[model samples]
Target: MMKKITIVASMSIVLLTTACKTKDLKMKEDRKEFISNKKEVVYQVFTRLFGNTNTTNKPWGTIEENGVGKFNDFTDLALKEIKDLGVTYIWYTGVPHHALIRDYSAIGISNDDPEVVKGRAGSPYAVKDYYNVNPDLAVDPANRLAEFEALIARTHQAGLKLIIDIVPNHIARKYEGMNNPNGVRDFGADDDVTVESKRDNNFYYIPNTQFEIPDTDAPLNGEKNPLVDGSFKEFPAKWTGNGSRRAKPDRNDWYETVKVNYGIRPDGSKDFPELPAHFDKKSAQEHFDFWKDKDVPDSWKKFRDIALYWTDKGVDGFRYDMAEMVPYEFWSYMNAAIKVKNPSAFLLAEVYNPDEYRNYIRLGKMDYLYDKVETYDKLKDVIRGHSLPDGLSDIQHRMVDIEHHMLHFLDNHDEQRLASPEFAGTPEKGKPLMVVSTTISTSPTMIYFGQEVGESAAENAGFGTHSRTSIFDYVGVPAHQRWMNNGKFDGGQLSESEKSLREFYKRLLNFSLNSTALMGAFQELQSVNRDSSWGYDPGIYAFCRWSTTEKLIVVTNFSWLTTSTFELKIPSSIIRKWNLVDGTYELTDQLYQESKLTLNVTHGEGRIHVVIAPSESFIYKL
Candidate 1:
């Protein structure tokens, strides 16, 4: 009986231990699955500049023309290329229809001008109708909805997300019915004005009462001459004829985009011209009310419906163009409404000014905004052969400042390319610098189209009224080989410099994707001593990213010359491993018998990489 009792006890103990081990293993597997699922890489594609099915002809027809031959299907062609790059998200730029009116007489046309007939008609930023998809981009006419659904389905199948562009600011300058030469019909303070003021025009004018700008030697309205008057002018008070003066034939007047008046007008008429037509506290609510329902002008209800239509079709997110120009409340409302349909949908805003962070993200609830400040300052400095100060302490501080809601990039469609000598100096020097900054920055990195290949910024690529041309030239090819044909300017035909940059980008991207430590939030390691070059060089930046389960240390050499004899002290509690990404390194035992890792960087070619090892960080364990 004693032997039997002991056997039973042992059996019970074994069973309990087995069950506990199984549970722990399952939990570990679950965590790994979660991390793997959350990994995402977004590839930006300028639709007009990307490859076209018809190589003989340009992708864009004319500004007024639609349904040009062999449209590039979003699902069939573009998404395939993105997936080939191992990217999980596709951010398609400027899919909406732009202005239709030809302003050649006013803006003056050049063959190389982006707005000219180089590719398609219309600027994607100048949205003509918010409620409709440009037919040119549509894959099927009768089953347009089906096509969009299929595209989303394909993206999901291929493990990718689709993000489209949304323009909430001023609509196309020549939006239909808005081009009426006569006074705006339904916009004034009247009950029976049935024309719907919101739909008739692309912009909602803000009345002058909300904010005030000092009147300096500001340019006069309608007059080419500069104002010499020293006296200040109440905004919207000095202007005449609804204050709507055509600044240029192609672009709308500045007053048209100014915020609406939120205060009560002195005349008691909401249509009082004396009030600066800015979207202020008072008029915004009314405009919101007017557009919330289908009854208001420009059909805000229809716009909402269009958004819903796309969301229902399964678009993952939207890249709102010129987001700063719109009201914060509008975005808040839109974001909430969109989230109701798709909770995980990403909302990215193209905000030029970083000062509007409070309005754009804090109050607005946006997911991400372009981090132009870091890209322009610290990143640019590194590429220009400037060493970071004190173990990149300054860079780390700046990174932390915008860490919560920042988007890092080496180049975007709006700026000059990093490959350009003017901006990046030279590809050989700039490529590695760009790679290091992108990898170590405290935000998810974004690679613009052709950036991997170090494509230089064309003359018309920057902010302009012209239609963007294909950054690469793709002409000739047989009829059957038309679709994504191996044309003259394929990805494989990159220049030597471009090829080097591309490989470097691929390495950085692969490193980020493979390592769990580099994808999420990280802590900057504080240096114990200030005398070391790693501690003082403004160019050498390093940071550690650690989750509860994983830890990673990323170090970057931003200078053109080799950095030698830099000492990095590791805590005795952590296990250290030395691996080289761009150069050679040796570990030495130093003070306190702790291992010291020394890295020898190559001249003009620096290293940027993440070191993943257990118990590596001083403060936290991953």
Candidate 2:
């Protein structure tokens, strides 16, 4: 998990004269419908902190001290700004009821012991109640689900889809469905606790063994819990969420929640029905039809119902956390059911195994999976000087079969910040990496909210030390807070450089969302230039993306400290395909048009003279 992706930077800013003050103003003048091949841009906003105005980033801070962002804070204007960023989907993380240090017993919700929770506000993955919403996100705790529903409505009204998390692998240690519909039953409600494993039992419990609190350091003991006596008793200890069989898991383990038993017995034999050979690449509707009368484990049905409940409430998709850990057959059932309800739903997963990528997408029915282990990791090596830019071409070559389903990203809540000391140390270092990440494939692109503005997670927010933004603490993100400008939803408080970096992201993302060439054809020019006689530097990565109507010759510099001028050649074969005439032509960098690049053509080979800034990219269109 420690091995990860890092920073980016830009060449120059390209400001459109028609750029209006806000999204509403710009849309009225320049907005256009999405074309046939434009990529979907997913903007992941950590829901709890997106609109928080507080700057006091106290470690393990309480909601009152750090201050919590509300559901209503994602106003119509805020949603529009995100929409204008060309985002098709908004992954609203931390929307469900999780194990946090809060008391909601008065409203039929049971309390989670502080010793079992992860930060002052526990991880969003540990669901305390599947039927309710996180009360901390609501202006009125009693109306939390209503507030989230309203946020969903606002997101759609602003022309963006909403994606929430569906963590099926585990539930909170204190799992209780406080608001389950009349016919539904909470997990473990009908289990026979004496048994260690049963095909239909919701949990794998250690009979007669009481669960012990992990011997973690005190700051995270979480505000004087009456249950922190280290004997937070469970008569029969359930298996820890990370699949640790230990009744007392260590602090380093996923000790916050318990894993749900999906009928995978201790011997790893499946009790549920397996997918047929023909179901491998079948349509979701086909999968749905296949499972219409089949019987599944109770846990599988519980999760499918949860997904459908949200879809009925207008939520368009889901981002499954640690999806590979869950059984494939369950996903075959759940995803197919979800698709039956909403065909275009965006279903993404955090799957790291390259070997299992195709299985998860084709058999598991996942729409997208993380490219973190492939191109993303290779890009990091290029930046850290561990490898050359050509390594990226190898990743592309191997992923050719499933390239479209691979999602590209430079930043996410789980990764280090673009400006973190552990990464590239400045927001200015993110532009070039971002350019390649966005344009290299036809897959969807995602950017964490603070990523565009270069949010350096210098604050030691609770569970996470630094580098990555804290998903488990109530801390305000510094750089993002500046962009928020006390709920103004404008970058009025950002530094000059921060503002410019944001402008670069805005232009780049907007272009990616509207460019047909990006979703058209991808031809690797890195190898061509690397083996060229004119001497191309290893820090430079060039490629060609084109459609019948649009063609882009992209060149990106991975060197953070060296500026270079080089001849980026557009190959003879490519030129012939474009039917470009044999002549000298002046081409403009579509991203930063201040300088004009000269392209010379002779004997079908075309060469362009370009001066690339350190850690910046040039997107030239003719």
Candidate 3:
């Protein structure tokens, strides 16, 4: 009876903490004036797969069969070539130590059970050690962290920022903090199993329960684990990463990982300090100041320390995985501490919920969110011929408030390749889309490695379906291997078509990288030109963008079968805004400057004739 009363008293103390004053939340209008500039090209490379030359792709293959890439593979010359693609930052995915099927038991790491790991290489999201680098990426396993540190130095030397993944939502089911620095405590090391929920407990436990291994009765990869004597035990089973409370989670569920607790009760009410209602209206530093003196939960502090430790290692930034799954307050707390360590840190996180976008940004302190579901999805629909060009206009209108804060990309680790059979089936089909995606807004643009030469990702990797490259298995990318040219880092072995495709990506990406208009002002001409021509196919779209010194008209034909010629009209409003008089101006295709076209202005309206081939786009500068 006394223990029950003590627990109740502690719960009351947690619920009775003072709330922040709402008056402090009303912020100055220039709240976003201090956001770090992120107008650079980010190239996301699944590091383990990027430079792997091995082509022996067998299902459920071992490291010796399907070889892994090392950190040294990112040679100085290789990085320079990527820079030639106009890349400013390189996000190295799967850098941290994660669970894998291989036996590193010789060294302190043990082979993870197949039932608890995703693929041969394992899912990168299931980090095993927060303080160590993946030994697979090192030339010498004993010096993996040193090799990664050298890579960081090399990336900075090549004038590119380095980005690594930080998965805050969960960790490997076999979560053990190996190689933790002094004073750093492993998660769940001090948990009290008697309680169902505690503010300081790192995980939520279904007390008095034991975890049941996922239902994998059928042999995985045609075999079952030799060590499986029908059970692997864990008393007081914790909730799975996907919020599955069942001890026996489904195979499709995130059974390989366990969720991290951040002071949210099982009923979803926050048990920690809440940011003031209008706190997002204030500057980022002010948000930081608000939490500077507050008592935060233990999980929040641990993640924050992890971030700071990396920032101290000269890491320029982090790309948070499934950021929205972790509470926004944790980001608000963690990112603030990161900024204090490195003010210009590039913090890009993946978020899908449109409704939570602003809160994740202004309150959660995320620098950029994935522009996937809105822009990327709509654009993909348009490319596959199921949707019209007007959807882009709708997206632009919807994202107007936070346009610059959304990062645009067609391919990432999680998405299908541009050339996969399930997608466009060829890299040529992505040219027009790439041009528009990179230039349509002022946000940062990201392109995956091998996306330029059209990596089909057709390898039947172990745990994942084909279409997207296997971040989980060690597999060589065919198209990219040609460009790697073994150790030459040149495209000497590339075929004519592959070389041409790379050239196209280079031209489009470089223009976006250097164009003043792209960063200055944007005005969509889609509405005006939608009905300008009689045969005006909805497959074509146009827009105008300008800076003081740069004024241009951009047009693209999304069709793969139709070569369309049309008179693209500039609305009277745009012509007047540009201060064009009743005269003719010479316009040249910046991409293919051998061609010149004429734009005639009459009665304050501009008329330009354009002939574009299938899957073609033009940047006409006046």
Candidate 4:
């Protein structure tokens, strides 16, 4: 009897060992699959302000007094520091040659009339030249393009892609492509200016009327230039960038820029060829083939060549400004060309209308769009204690089909700073908000230059007021300067709170980038926990992200004054999907790794008691 029992025990031991090896092999396969799916992290820096160390921050300051960051400022060390921050793409905002108030005539660049310029530095969207880099961004204005190319090489050397603005909807009032390639003509060079609208005209004209500068108190920088005399010479007034029809646009209008006519008549009818039926379902290569032999509008050919020019220069992608203002057909054509040239080119657009989101992605062939109207607005409401966290579930549900195409960001050049009183009154509130933004979906995440260091943007920088950083003025970003630390590119002068905030950003961003589960399936646990668990409140949010080999439970508390002690629950449906059974498991905080919690499962349902301090978040990995 003893010999028979030993044989049975030996057989059981072998079976258990086999099961262990099978489980290990499955885990390795799951990891390989997860690694194939990558989530991108973009770091946006205002090109003129990122490396500027001068803290003068004078309102309406000149580039000489306030100083400007050059292409050389993005040294190998600076690029390395940005890459170490877990950024995959570096968006060099305001890199293109735009209409600025500064004079660079020695390099054959024309001076822009200050009356038509936004501020001393001018708006980057008001692009003056498309074929050349901004002369103001070069140490040697004569070799500006070469300097920018060097920066591009350094960016690639640091193992990061580069993105620059491509403003397709409009151009500066004083448009001039001085460095246009041989045989390439300027935008309006071939236009018939006497007509109100033409299929091939680059701009719309209010025939027989001269352009008049809007009546304002003064030029944004206190009339520093002699040319700020309330006059800009245009033979026939063109339509304003915002589609104003009058000879004199309102002060609130986008007066600094003139609209580009994309074969759409003044009556809002398409004069260009429309896409064929069911073309949205076709591939980009198919679209490219369709337009290959077809005759397109002149403006179409111009912009396409411009985009191809930058693509040839090693620019990895573009952030198109006000893309929705242009026709969807143009994007289908333009994006198809870009994709054919560089199959991996990242195409991000600023499209706000939610109804047009799918059309832009499917037909326009765009990779991503700003989630401003839905996700951004809803998150801001939740952060301000004006709404509950449950609404995020509804948003996720609505966007499930295209969730991966929505790029999430808490701060950008266009938004109010998170640390400003106008936003959340403190940078600490960003902790929970950012935790949600980065990990809530499979979409890419973006971080503005000073967002990590809590730049309040309290300075009233001339044309732009307090709450948002000035894109139109030559000014120093104070918080970012401390991080620059006199070109060392380290946070040498950062305060304790600022340092902690940056570290929090670093931890969350890095984890979100490398975590395989974030790029996998996601399920919101908010509704389930609220219905079944105790200590649940509107201030708390919970979700589950899982892959074949990894599972994560994320929870955040937005309340600045109240601590949340809650029993977070993961429902049976998600448990079954995660292939989890009735058992006890250990969950550790992936962000801080400072705590370990026990998750007890029974009947396929899991529950864990969690204590989230005010404005804190946890990515508990199981």
Candidate 5:
């Protein structure tokens, strides 16, 4: 009897273990399913300004006076609040070490000459070290990289990925990689400075020209620095970051940086091998295989190693600055190598030329490119009342082939703030524009820090003035501070209007995150409704997005004073695609559930009447 009881108990334990294993496997599968289907929403935060509580508006203020935010400032509560905004990724801009006018000689970090730097903080694009984090952003300067790694771990723990910048086209005028690993030499260390261009040289020298500082009315902006004596020693000046082949670059040029040469000669001829014909259609792994044994430039190898090093340290991806300035072949080799280490690394680039979009995405292996020239420009005009909302349909039609590869943003560090007088003059105006930009296609949506709470960037911070946030100075973003609430990250100090706007953003963004239709097929409904009895006008833009199980109807009213009431028509083509029968279906607003609307389908046609206020948008579930 005892032996029979023991056998029965052993059988029960085995069955229970098997059941638990099956449940865990299913959970993993579900997580992967959600990751593959959800649309990505990226929150871009300027690393220095995100958590600064200093209210001092001193122009050209030093870090101690203005107070800089540290990596530890991104506390768990702070990251959780950001993740709760429906953000899939957090892009920490200015994480890499850059030239700044601070005396860090105690830590082996040489102070940058004010004559060669942009502002007190220096430009984030002017990278001084690729293998190290900005010392200014660390609580303990000696453990700067470790602090950044801890932040990376915290960000991932909050279920959000992290992205850092990689300025591969150039480096700080005085480059120094203090944290470079063994056997990895610094950029331009072995350069033959006597030649105009060499196949293996990291930089292109002007042969015999000496570097001359650009003439400026206010040298060092009146800052008294011994090094700002209108002299910076450089033998055989290299080309400027903006491809200016001059010994003394123009004041407006990227004079603080020296350009990296990727085997492209000064005469516009390729010194390296070009990608083979039809190579654009190959996968990243295939591209990786193709370049494994190919002879590439030293600059290319250095960048690839930098990227891989960051990846091994838990960096999820990189945002390539001025990507178009570099050769596409170099990107193919560099991005492919990154993919081999981490297949899902996010590779976003700033390629403004619309003509080179496909070549950059396909051959360059970039996952996303800025949709600035086409979509962002059109939307900017529409919001400024310079263009009708109807023009968005034409823009969307042109880029249908590569729509998903585009990333949309209403404001970035490079653009004016929505609440600034130079822009729309009110954060409310961004409602319709944000709705259109975020849900217009299957592209990723990006929101700059302080955008949600309406940061006007009104301070006249030395290097960069009003209209845009100053990336080149030690400063604080006021409206964003209200949201940060002294690192509570709970929007405790925000005004009612600011809170309401942030809530609107939260709802729309969360909807986009969970909705399958957002990442599915899209069709414009404006052209069909323009002729209908619905009184559809150019000020109104409407569209539809649907998948096998979910369908959405989105409409926006761009006029600031006009409240539009229209009978939006979903034509027979869309109705057939959606497979709707002749019945009345409830259409609920996903953004604000204030409107009671329904779609009436009759004989293969769908119609719904919507009343949208000025600067209002409706994302309806049909």
Candidate 6:
């Protein structure tokens, strides 16, 4: 009887040991997968604002300045500077050939105006040729590929990923060989009267339609329309004849950008009014359809080749500009092609809308989209003296809506800076605003150049380049000096408020990068009671993120002067003890064992950073 009992006991021990080994193996696999899925941070660079290699002849300076018309090489100095910023991805804006059309200037200016000529670096959105790199941005005339390769290599060596801008919607009006065959001229109204009148070009009349109405009612599609009334309705312009009148520059000139007609008919007989006269309507449709179907035209395939060319040279991804405007089918095909060439390649699309567009996530069109809704709405609330809402719930919904989709940024090239006095109350109030934006948001964040230094607006200037628009002050200085003086501008240096804001941002970024809680998925924690001040204010928000084995809590006080206090209900078995590393709060083991803890926070005192010690994050052992 004793021998039988011993045998049974031995069998049970062996079975338990085998189960333990299996669980360990599974955990290892899970860990590997989790690490692989970690998100990356991308920093955008306006190369022109970065520096000029030649001080005597600053290349790519305005044409009036007799600039050498080329960008500097990927200097080791520049790479080191960017590396110190603690970002994983570097997005180089406008690396391609600038628009060839020099005839018409942007709104609020004439073509011959000195400011117009000086500021005419050519809109990067208007692509002249996909194959050619802008000479101004190239380090060497002939070794463009080599220069690009070297840049990519250096970026990779510094533990950074490179993402170049890609404009897919429109090409330059005067591409060398691909000129507007339709005789459509930009400033043709001022040219020879007879010649301009005879041409049945689309550019002759700028549509003054309102966009308030749906696309179906708009005269020339909904693309070119003004906002009318409170709602977005489209009303035809007061112009008499089809090609008789020209609309004002800012209001309607952008309408001249023709829309592409995807082939819907089998015979391709549709006459797309947006097609340039030089292009055969049917042939253009066929061309567009070929690419849409993945049978890309050899000529058009150059765009894909450009992306692959850079990727093979070690670029990490492409920030596809105007991605939403392009046909969904094209991106679906493009993403597949990109993955085949480089699986690890990150594709970020500049999609502005929150609605699920045709190629959003289901088609695998892009890995990330510019999350405008979160930035403009949610982030706006916190800055406007409102409480930070239950962001975790919204984040959960967004995560479920688009799995593996990266959230883009609060500010980019097209928008004004959040730190600008226009948005964040004043320069004094900007620091707290910046903290909330960088830390509280769930998406992987992006930092525009000069943001870290808290560079505010210049006198009577907007946020980007023309006025306070510069990423850095690059006037009349050597490349090294300009590079070294990155965060400072010539006339507009960083203020005391700006310095503090910059340091705060740096710390927040480092903390986010280091914390698994901020980097990983978050779970919304339930409040103990709805009557509590924290729960009553829609702006006050709190959430907890936990790895399979570790847990973290994040709370934000969004009110201006109110103090918020709330109790946390944690599972006693999972959390043994937790400490707030921000060192503002004192939490004991009794609180954890009881599975309850009350948090008291002062409002508008900047984000009350609560950190847990002895962990990469403020962690509680489960």
lDDT of each: 0.44, 0.82, 0.82, 0.85, 0.85, 0.44
Q: Any residue pairs clashing in model 4, and if so which?
A: none
Candidate 4 on 29-63: residue-level lDDT in tens? 33342123767999999998888988887888788
Worst 10 residues of 2 by lDDT: 20-29
Worst ten-residue run, lDDT, model 5? Answer: 17-26
Worst 10 residues of 3 by lDDT: 2-11
Clashing pairs in 5: none
Better of 2 and 4 by lDDT: 4
Two-way lDDT contest, 2 vs 5, winner = 5
Model 4 ranges off by over 4 Å:
1-36
What's the TM-score of each model vs. the native? Answer: 0.61, 0.93, 0.93, 0.94, 0.93, 0.62
2 or 6: which has the higher TM-score?
A: 2
- Please give me the total number of clashing residue pairs in predicted model 5: 0
Which of candidates 3 and 6 is the stronger one according to TM-score?
3
Instruction: List pairs with backbone clashes in candidate 2.
Output: 8-429, 8-430, 8-431, 9-429, 9-430, 9-431, 9-432
In candidate 2, what are the lDDT values of residues 250-323, reduced to their tens digit? 88888888999998998889998898997786989998988899988888888999999988999899999999
**lDDT at residue 153 of model 2 (Cα atoms):** 83
Error in Å for residue 144 of model 3? 0.5
- Segments in model 3 whose C-alpha atoms lie over 4 Å from true places: 1-38, 217-220, 223-226
RMSD of model 5 against the true structure: 14.6
Supply the TM-score for candidate 4.
Answer: 0.94
Compute the lDDT of residue 91 as modeled in candidate 5.
94
lDDT of 6 at 73: 38
